[model samples]
Target: MPIVLYHFPLSPPCRTALCTAKALGLDVTIKIVNLLAKEHLNEDYVKMNPEHTIPSLDDNGLIIWHSHAIATYLVSKYGKDDSLYPVDPAKRVVVDQRLYFDATTLFPRLRATTFPLMFLGKTDVEPDKKAAIYEALGILEKYLEPTGWVAGDHVTVADIACAVTTATLQAMGVVLDAYPKIREWLERCNSTIPHFEEANKEALKDVAELIKSKVTHNVYAP
Candidate 1:
């Protein structure tokens, strides 16, 4: 049986997994779990993924959720070599750090601002939330300063993991102009990744439209 992925297209976490799988040339059966319809709350899906999160992977009988973990696993188990996720401890540490940064710092900050607007029709992001998003972006800028990629020279699962979230923030109209390094790195990721448009662009457009329809004011300034 083909590997199965349960995902919601507009979700960055879901897109991250999709992009990683595509990068590794892994064939997956895509099953859309519409969050708006609460399909993830179904009994069967809940049993497989108690967290009921998007982008859950069912590899044979094994199950996994969380984009970063899934991304790394795909590269580790399926990738012909350790290029996307190097086996060397010193090199892998940088990738691991960036992945952790995305999970703990970047995605949470972006979600804080966009989630209320997208799901609850909030018109504006709270001052603190907006500030937090920029703060996270600032940190990302520094991370990118030393190397072209988030995790060093080569494009790793770290870039795939963080780029999807960064792309979603851009779709939400976050001003990335202030973070020149991030903007450049995002451009590089978008261009270099195969099937980048199919993996991320279209869903990013959906997220942009959803945000535009619900929110009247711009949350990102400067």
Candidate 2:
């Protein structure tokens, strides 16, 4: 059976899974879920993804909702080789760490910063929220300094996952001068990753414009 993906173009998680599938050369039927219209809360979509998040993949009968999991599944089942997700246990562990870093550390900050501006009508990013995002960027910089990639020397699923998060944060007006390694790594990802622009650029611009309409101040500004 063919894969069917439930996606929102502006969502980082959706872009992550979409880019992963593209890199693996997998054909997927895209179904747009309009968050503004609450389409993700519909009965069937929620049945497929209990959390009701974007980028749920229905691979035949198996359902994967989370982007990291979707990426892993696509690579394991269809990839010609395991480069995107290494077969070696030691190597896989590093990729796992970076994935969680994106999920637990990186993604939450995006939600925290955006939720208020988008949903609660907050005009400025709270100081703590702004600081939290920079802190994650600092941690990512430390990770990238050694190998120029988040997980290992090669671009793995880890980089794909983090790239969308980092790029989205940048488009939302996060300053990068303090995190030079991340800036350089993002450039490298743009150059190397297949379908990077197709998955991220236009969606990122949309996110930035949406947020710009709400936020009166750039939190990272002095």
Candidate 3:
């Protein structure tokens, strides 16, 4: 049986899993979990993923959720080589660090600033949240100072993970002009990463539209 991936296209984490699967040439059946409709909160999905997050993978009987874990497992079990996620201790530590950075720092900052606007009909970002996002971006800029990719010279799963969030922010009108290295690295990843457009760009359009639709309606509108 082909792996079943429960996902919503506009989600950056979902795109991370999709991009990793494509890079590893794994056959996956995508089942869209519509967050707008709260399908992910349904009992069946909750049973499969207690956390009820999108991009959970069911490979035969085994199940794995969390985008980074899914990506690492796919690379470890199915990759022809460890190039995307090196097995070497020194190299793998760096990759792990980048993944944690995406999950804990970068993505959370983006979510904090945007989720209220996207989901709660907020019209503006708070000063602190905006500062948090820029602080995270600055750290990413420093990380990319030494190499073109987030983890290193080569495009790893870390690049896929971080770039999806970066692209999402870009779609949401966050400027990258100040972070020239990040801009350049994102350009490189877009050009070289397999299925980059399919996995990220089209879905990002949907995210932009969703956010616009939500925020356009004022809470006090008649």
Candidate 4:
């Protein structure tokens, strides 16, 4: 059976796993879980992942949830190149640690600062959220360099994982103009991975419309 990847595009965690899958040349049957339907919060999905979240991998009937865990599992099991996930124990440890930080720390902060305005349709708080976004971006700025990737010289799965989240957050209208390194890194990641863009083909339009609708409605309405 083909591996099944459960995901919701709007979710950063789901995108992380998807990015890793793309990077590794894995043939996955994507099951777009409906987060909007609260399907993730429902009992059936909860059985697959008690946390009730996505970017989960179902491999020949075995389920692995949590985006970081799923991505690590894929790399450990099926990565085509060592650069995608280094075999060196120390390098792997550093990359895995960063993956955890990106998954639990950076991603949550980005969400806290953007999701309320973007997904929740809450426009009145955009200015405040934008400030929070800059703060979180500054955190990311500290780790980023002109090195062309995150975590190392080679574009590891860590870069794929973090880039997907950062790209989505930027797509949500969190300004990245000040973070030139991040912008360059994003382009580098896209150029390196052919499948990341394919999997996210519809995301740009949706995010653009969502941001525009909220901003326009908020600005014009009395």
The digit string of per-residue lDDT tens for model 2 on 55-122 reads 89998888888899999999999999999999999999999999999999999998997888887878
Q: Encode model 3's per-residue lDDT on 1-222: one tens digit a residue.
A: 999999998788999999999988888999999886899999999998999988899999899999999999999999999999999999999999999999999899888867687678788767777777777889989989997788877989999999998888877767777899999988888889877766787888887776666654322111
| Model 2 stretches with alpha carbons more than 4 Å out | 220-222
lDDT of 2: 0.90
lDDT of 1 by residue, 1-222 (tens): 899999899888998898989988889999999998989999999999999888899999999999999999999999989988999999999999999999999999988877787677789888888888889989889888887788878889898888899888888888998899998988898889877667887888898888878866666765
* Ranking 1 against 4 by TM-score, winner: 1
Error of 2 at 20 (Å): 0.1
Best of the two (3, 4) by lDDT? 3
Per-residue lDDT of model 4, residues 65-155, tens digit only: 9888898889889976677778899888878877887867778766675556656776654455556556666766766764556777777
Q: Give the lDDT ranking, best first.
A: 2, 1, 3, 4
In order, candidate lDDTs are: 0.88, 0.90, 0.86, 0.75
Clash count per candidate: 0, 0, 0, 0
Pairs that collide in candidate 2 are: none
